[model samples]
Target: MKVGLYFGTFNPIHTGHLIIANHMAEYSGLDQIWMVVTPHNPLKKKSTLLEDHHRLQMVFLATEDYPKLKPSDVEFRLPQPNYTVNTLAHLQEKFPTHEFSLIMGEDNLNSLHKWKNYDVLLQNHHIYVYPRISTDKLNPEFENHPKIHMIDAPVVEISSTFIRNGVKEGKNVQPLLPHKVWQYIEHNLFYKK
Candidate 1:
C-alpha cells in the first residue's frame, strides 16, 4: 500500500484541509492520505495550539466520512518538536511493506532545504506538492526531479489561523469547519477568547 503523509498541527481540522486531502488521494495516485497530527512542529510556536488530544479528536471528526483519508496520532508518542525525517523513518521501519510519500503545499517546497535530512527525504520518498496562493514557483534544483510530483489540487484560501482568529472574536466559523468538528469546537469552547 502507498500512503501520503499530510502532516500538520490541525489545531482544528477544517474543510480546506479535507478538500486538500481528498484531492491528493484522488489525483496523487496514493491509496491513502493520512493526516499526521504532529504534537509539536519544530518550526512553529506551540502557544496558540490546542491540546494535542483535542486537536487529534478534531481531526478524527473532520475525516470520519472520508474512507481514503485517515487521522493519525503517530507523532503523539514520539518526542516533542517532532521532525519529519524522524517520523518518516519510524513509520517506514514499523510498516516496511507500505510505501510512504509526502503531501505538502508548494509553499513548503521553498523551505525544503531547511528541514532536517531533507535530501534524504527527497531521495527516499515521493513528494506531492499542491499549489498555494502567493507561493513562488518550485526552486530550479527540484523543478524536474523525478521524485517530485507537482499537482493541481484545488487550493482554498481558508486556513486554521483564519478560523482561530474568527473563533476568538466570537464569530461563527461553522462554514469553514466540518460539521462534526465545528460542533465539537463549539461545545468545548475551543479558541474562545
Candidate 2:
C-alpha cells in the first residue's frame, strides 16, 4: 500500500485538514493519508501547542469516519522534538511492505534544506507539495530535487492558529471545523482562555 504521511501538530483537527486529506486520497495514487501527530515538531515553537495526547484524540475523532484517513500516534513512542526524516526512517523499517511519501506545503519545502538530513529525505522518498500563499520565493536548490511533485490542494485561509485565537476570544468556530470536531472542542472547552 502507498501512504502519504501528513505530519502536523493538529492542535485541533478541523475540516480544512479533512478536505485536504480526502483530496489527496481521491486524486493521488496514495491509498491512505496518515495524520502523523507529532508531540513536538523540531522546527515549530512548543509553547502554544496543546498536549500531544489531546491533539491526537481530536485527530482521531475528526478522522474516525474516513477509512482512507488514519490518525497515527507513531511519534508518541519516538523521542521528542520529532523530526520528519527520523519518523520516515522508523516507519519504513516497521512497515516495509508499504511505500511512504511525504505530503507537505510549499512553505515547508522552501526551508526543507535546513531540516535534519534533508538530502537523505530528498533521495529516499517522494514529496507531494501543496501550494501555499507565498511560495514563489522558494530557494533555487529545491527545484532540482528528484522526487518533488506539486498538487493543487484547495486553499482555505483558516489555520489552527486562527481557530485557537477564536476560541480564546470566545468566538464561534463552527464553520472552521466539522460538526463532530466542533462539538468535541466545545465539550472539552479547548483553547478557552
Candidate 3:
C-alpha cells in the first residue's frame, strides 16, 4: 500500500487539514493519507500546544468519517522534539510492507534545509507538497527534483493558531472546524482562557 504521511500537531484538526488529505488521497495516487499527529515538533513552540492525548483525540474526531484519512499516534511513543527523519525511518521499519511518502506544504519545502537529516529525507522518500498562501517560492535547488511532487490542492489560509485564538477570544470557530471537532472543543473547553 502507498501511504502519504501528513504530519502535524493537529492541536485541533480543522477543515483545512481534511481538505488537503482528501485531495492527496483522491488525486495524488495514494492509497491512504495518514494524519500523523506529532507529539512535539522540534522546531515549534511548546507553550501553547495542547496535551498530546487531547490533540490525538481531536484528530480522531475529525477524521473518523473519512475512509481515506486516518489519524495516527506514531509520534507519541517517539522521543520528545520528534524529528521527521527519525519518524520516517521508524515508520519504515514498523510497516515494512507499505511504502510511505511525506506530505507537506510549500512553506516546509522552502525551509527543508533546516530540518534534521533533510538530505536523507529527500533522497529516500517521495514528497508531495501542497501550496500555502503567501509563502516563499519553492527553493531553486529542489526545482524539477524527481522526489518532490507539487500538488495543486485548494489553499485554505485558516490555521490551528487562528482557530485557537478565535476560541480563546470567544468567537465562533465552528465554520473553520469539522462539525465533530468543533463539538469536541466546545464540550471540552479547549483553548479557553
What are the lDDT figures for the candidates, one per model?
Answer: 0.90, 0.87, 0.91
- Tell how far residue 134 is off in model 1, in angstroms: 1.8
lDDT for 61 in candidate 1 is 89
**Tens-place lDDT digits, model 1, residues 8-32:** 9898888999999999999879999
lDDT of 3 by residue, 105-191 (tens): 998889898999999999899999999886476789889999999999999788899999999999998999999889989998889
Query: Which residue runs does candidate 3 get wrong by more than 4 Å?
Result: 41-46
| TM-scores of all predicted structures | 0.95, 0.93, 0.95
> Model 1 Cα RMSD, Å?
1.6
Clash number for each model: 0, 0, 0
Worst 10 residues of 2 by lDDT: 39-48
How much does candidate 1 score in TM-score?
Answer: 0.95
List of clashing residue pairs for candidate 1 = none
Cα lDDT for residue 46, candidate 1: 64
What's the best-to-worst order under lDDT?
3, 1, 2
